[model samples]
Target chain A: GAGVSQSPSNKVTEKGKDVELRCDPISGHTALYWYRQSLGQGLEFLIYFQGNSAPDKSGLPSDRFSAERTGGSVSTLTIQRTQQEDSAVYLCASSLARWDTEAFFGQGTRLTVV
Target chain B: AQRVTQPEKLLSVFKGAPVELKCNYSYSGSPELFWYVQYSRQRLQLLLRHISRESIKGFTADLNKGETSFHLKKPFAQEEDSAMYYCALSKAAGNKLTFGGGTRVLVKP
Candidate 1:
């Protein structure tokens, strides 16, 4: 892909419903990151995947938030029992690799929990 | 724990005026600093990185290790420069980044 691509650019889900967000990072890029952007807020780190290394999930806000990267290419973020507070933009980014490299960001998924 | 701070939430400048957006970071090890911008209706994109030390769209940032600041600067502000700017930092050899609160710049013509 020319850049990072996220699916369901906009999503509206009812409270308690589960939602899945997808990200396809730039081909051959080895590092992927997930972030959450709330209204008028800074980007909040969610998770990161580097090649086949164990993912860094320290930033996940709660047990309901989980993510996984398959084959080191595509990734999915699953939110279970979503809450109104979960409404925000979910962004994905990828870089050639970690360490001193530039990252390309996707359009982002705006998830609205109604 | 790495952290980035952008004190000003909004900055307004007249066209042709010099502009500076402040950013500070706190990290124990050597850090990689970057500025990302989000234009109206556009996706967030990287404006510049400290390691590259290259200016983009007339914007440049200097990373000062002593002050732990990476401030973005431009000699002349343009209306097109109006956008939300975020400063971020990552520890050397790490992938995760901590981002600042972001500053919205408005250039009046």
Candidate 2:
């Protein structure tokens, strides 16, 4: 694709239910990132994937949140036993390189937990 | 640990006026700072980075180590500049980034 793509642009899920958000970064891009934005808040770093493996997982808020990228392309963020606080826009981005490079972002998936 | 801070939640300016958005950070190692903007209904995109030392759409940011500030500035603001701005910090240690709370900039015509 020309740009990063995210699935389920908007999602509504009940509290305690699980949710999965998908992201497909730009083709040939080597770095992928996940960020969360709460209502009226800044972007919060979640995890990063260099290729198909996540080398940085320290940003994950809690154990309930886990993510995986397969084939260094498609990535999925899974939130287990979702809480109301989990509701936020999940954005994915990809950069040409690992550092000091411009990153392109997806439109983001607006997750609503009720 | 690395951290980024955006001081203002909202900033409004008239067209052609000068605008500045403040960002501060805390990191022991050398830090790279970046400004990202998200226009209405659009994806967040890079406005500029300190390393590049380039200006986009007449916007510039200078990284001050002593003060730990990286503020985005524009000499002449346009209504099209209205957007949500974020300050991000990255160090050589890892691939992760620390972002500050965003500031919503509104440029009125």
**DockQ winner among the candidates?**
1
Per-residue lDDT of model 1, residues A10-88, tens digit only: 9999999999999999999989999999998878889999898899999999999999999989999999999999999
Query: Which residue segments of model 1 deviate by more than 4 Å?
Result: none
Find the 10 residues in a row with the least total lDDT in model 2 chain B.
Answer: B90-99
| Docking class for candidate 2 | medium
- Window of ten residues with lowest summed lDDT in model 2 chain A: A49-58
Per-model TM-score of chain A alone?
0.98, 0.95
**Collision pairs in model 2:** none
The lDDT of each candidate is 0.92, 0.89
